[model samples]
Target: MAIDLYALPVTQVSGVKGKKPEELLALGITSVGQLLDYYPFRYEDYTLRDLTQVKDGDKITVQGTIAGVPQVQMYGRTKSRMTCKIVVDSLFITAVWFNRHFLRDKLTAGAEIVLTGKWDQKRLHLTISETEFPGQGKSQTGTLQPVYSITGALTQKWMRQTMKQALLQFGELIPEVLPAELLTRYDLLPRKKAMALLHAPGSLEQGQQARRRMVYEELFLFQLKMQAYRALNHDRADGVAHPVDLPAVRAFVRALPFTLTASQKQVLAEILHDLQQPHCMNRLLQGDVGAGKTVVAASALFAVVKSGYQGALMVPTEILAEQHKRSLDRLFEPYGIQTALLTGSLTDRQRRDLLASLQMGLIDVVVGTHALIQEDVYFRQLGLVVTDEQHRFGVNQRSILRRKGMNPDVLTMTATPIPRTLAITAFGDMDVSTLRELPKGRKPIQTYAVTPAMLERVLGFIRREVSAGRQAYVICPLIEESEKLDVQNAIDVHAQLQFAFPEYRVGLLHGRMTASEKDEIMRQFSSNEVQVLVSTTVIEVGVDVPNSTLMVVYDADRFGLSQLHQLRGRVGRGEHQSYCILIADPKNEVGKERMKAMTDTNDGFEIARRDLELRGPGDFFGTKQSGLPEFRVADMVTDFETMEQARDDAAELVRRPDFWTGASYASLRQFLQRENIFTGDLLD
Candidate 1:
């Protein structure tokens, strides 16, 4: 009997015996299905390389016949090298292999062979990493060759052989999961055909079709899952009917220190509208740093409290929660709305009092970390749930908090700017409102990319700023020493900067510090007690100080463009003209582009676009999202239209029981399960 494709291990397959199983496991290739998902990252067009056009330093592939016996050169007893001469139609090139003396017999005269490696122009030699011969039955020029990510134990030769075997045996059994309508609309190939073409295409064009099919499949299923979530959340019992217009809430908004920007006013209005809806409100509020997201969230929370209901705000870190507590406490105190703080570091008595107040409706609003989702914490009449930094928490975590009450309105906020296309795909289930404009009275920070040669001049500038009654933030890429990465860290930068500014106060902040220690350090920095705060990315959010006027980021190239923008935003809040100095000597072109983007514009959206284009969507979306699935083929920048179509199709499918809730959707269900997406969980 043949084995099942889903459960059959690579060890059970032919040609995959021996230590290949262990090597395969290192690449997450345990089961046949997983092995199939491990498609080649790229392919080498060995079938059509012209030997005449091959240049030095270029990676090329060529097919030729052995013209003579191989030469073995020995250096010492343990070091040996083998060299062979191969000829094409009228051209000849020397191929070299290191430490493979046994290959001499295989290089006999007139042997047809394929070689792929770097071409050394200086010696006109090809340093071959892969070689295939017709006699061995491994070299086939008719098929485009696959190049995959490899480990030392697992080479491309073995991987290709194993994948080929798997496809030949199981490809026929792979079911068609996409509906016929979608297949016709998108011109996609059947699943089995796509697998065959993608794993071992006879031509490059066929491989392209396979790629489109796979990308469509990934984004299609992902959008379906997101649409299902929206449907489930919308179908839930009506949420709290919080009153939006109340005397206290109106008064609080009028009393705000600075006028709300046009973007903020629009988003605030949208939030209030969502709160008035009968169904549960699921919305994502996005903006750049200093875009007044907190104030917008505060306004919504105020409306909830004014209507005599409780509101909860969850942040990524304890320091951020504490800062929100202080900021909101001050904002709502005049409005007579009580606020409480709950975090992991809170004392037993303090937590007890807060929980008790929450249950009794004494605490109108609560700002907390993940502790807000604990089973023990209960809300009196939870009307709204607001989360800062939406990417830090998944939809389930947000739902976990919402489940504590009767379907509370969910408003998630993020300081990072997501591209419009990404916003649709990632936040498809929720209404999105963007705040692109910063609040009034905010000064733009000047950014400049500097090399290490200007370190002295930058330090002198910081000294001048501090002496003029302004504080500075010096950010490092790492907290402590990392053996793998040779980058500046907070501790070393702290010691060096302390010496640089002996007369001024220099404090250090990193992730290794305890909650109280970080809070105290931030407090000192806020009070201008620490003129220079040499910290890691710990101050990425909510370390707002109007007096801080300068930011100096060491190794700025190590950070993403969006992150660099966030770090630059720490300063420039005050009325004075601010400056941001980025000390970076970028090694690669991408790093150079990131530094240039930071110094070019203050627009977060533009930075995000550049970051997406430069790093590709994979790295940009990895940590920037929590529950979103990683795409293997579909790029948001390239497949924007496909993503949009998938979004529409998925939404329609969810409304039909014949597809969404039936056996036809079984494969999609399995895919979502693997992606860790469940609409039932969101219905909670």
Candidate 2:
């Protein structure tokens, strides 16, 4: 159904009458429904009151009689904020208003008003920046106050008032979506009731319940959309079955220098089964670092080859692509699997040769970066596509690759094992295969957190490692010092190491270096030409030399837990024991906590959980990194359990797809469309 403009009601304050709806639309507040549905970003709870509970300088609601008159000072104003003071319950608190002083009149002396604001405990004074009155009732300040996201033209008060008015006027449009039976069974309030509680609740408990209802609803709807997509895909006619020759893949694995681990074999079996499915495969491969995702991917590629079809592997960066190509080339050579590399960095002659091989169907396994998805590129018989660190690429890029084939099986691999809650909420539409165990003979990288005082010992250890014919890696925080202050740099550290240990060779690598320079440095380190390599995180995944055993990270606190884990993965690649030392400051609690968490557990999943609990979803998941959904109400971290239940409900709803044909589901879809929560970007 098309959007119903009448579903949203107009408010007297939405516009000044003569201005444009087009103008309002530009502000993302076009429809009355949008205005009503524009939920608050946060809430300020100032409903609790009582002088007995109030401490000195506390921003509290004192119900005592006002003993003095308020004062308004003509303080010099810059571009914002005004200076004023008001007395409530015989206590003095500074009042600051942005541009509006109409508050002065409403907050008269001895007027028995409740002021809500911040306070300085040391100064024994409160900054009553906001005011409330009994006449305004609970609208001004209640258990939960709606704090809508606002533009310059819309103040918090304005948004609240406009939403309140819209709610009052558009009573007929706010239809309920959940069944009456389910509502009563789940003890959930109606949307209208929840909205009321959200804006103005009589008690904190009511506001929490209302929040729970809204969050669950929002999560359920999102999950339902995902399940719908899954259902729709399931209904599509599957492609021809591409049978997998398990014997061939097993023989290839058996011929390998190392034996496949239980987890690797398990995941490989799942991938093989997926490739054999008549439907085009859309699988997610989640494996911890050093869990042998590459071998599993190779096995899938073998199946593709056995089926008389070619496979394509895409990486996010040219460096990583080159690395994967080199690694896969070695593995495929013994099996007579014709493999080739294609990337932007390749010379014209090289690219032409590679393209020729690809077009001729001679390259059985082609690995490259986004260059594979270029418009000019064509595949002879691309049967399967493997994307390494698939999370780094956006959904659009993934889709573009899929469109390159006749619906080839897609196997996306990620080094990070996403939390289960995130996988459900963010990647519910895709099938997932997890490689949870590390391969045999891999030593656990011992991790430690130390202060600057231990720096000398760390350097001494590096010297000892290099002297023993093994290599070590020292990662600096930055390439150059900032203008703010001069900090240690990779270049400077390399020089320092060379000078201190004149007996050993030291090399430096950073992001600022040229590709040739980075390659040369990496080549040197790989061949053990350089005993010690000092660099930035650029080498975090660049090379895989087992000789490097000692890993030292300077200012480890600056890096996220997952990032630190990734860096630690650079070492301990060999059978010998390896160590990761994190040098940090002990006094900084945030830094200390991050370091402690890293040291406390070598488990990536545990680290991720702690990272979430300590820093929230944004910092833990690296919003920019994960591309995870950012919900204002639903938190995948704190609300994991609830999100699971919502996901189940979503699945059930999708099984009964006709439920959305109802007017209520239409309205629900309309609400989601307005919020961009179910936008096509998610599935693209």
What's the CA RMSD for each of the models? Answer: 3.8, 4.4
Lowest summed lDDT across 10 adjacent residues in model 1 is found at 675-684
Please report how far candidate 2 places residue 543 from its true position, in Å: 4.0
Q: What is the TM-score of each candidate against the true structure?
A: 0.88, 0.87
| Clash pairs, model 2 backbone | 8-33
Q: Spell out the clash pairs found in candidate 1.
A: none
For model 2, the stretches where C-alpha displacement exceeds 4 angstroms are 1-28, 48-113, 120-123, 131-143, 200-202, 484-487, 618-627, 653-684
Runs in model 1 lying further than 4 Å from the true structure: 1-38, 52-57, 65-72, 84-92, 105-113, 121-123, 133-136, 147-166, 228-236, 246-248, 394-396, 481-484, 621-625, 651-680
Give Cα distance to truth, residue 52, candidate 1, Å: 4.5
lDDT digits (tens) for residues 1-684 of candidate 2? 433544443434344244444445656666675655667767776664654466665655433234344455443663344445555445665555555454556655566666666655555455655666666755445456667666555567766666676667664456676656457767998987887667656677887898898888778777777776776666354544687788888898998889888888888888787777777777888877788888788888988898889999998766677778888888888888998878877888888888888888888988888888888677888899898877667666777887777878888888766777766766777788888788888888888898889878888888777877889999988987767744467877888899988887789998888767777888888898888899998876535788899899988887777778888888888877989999887777888988888888877778767777777776654545455676757777878988888788767765775665765466556655564544333263
Per-residue accuracy of model 1 over 240-355 as CA lDDT, tens digit each: 65667856656777899878888888888888878877777888899988888999999999998877788999998998999999999889887678898899998999999989
TM-score of 1: 0.88
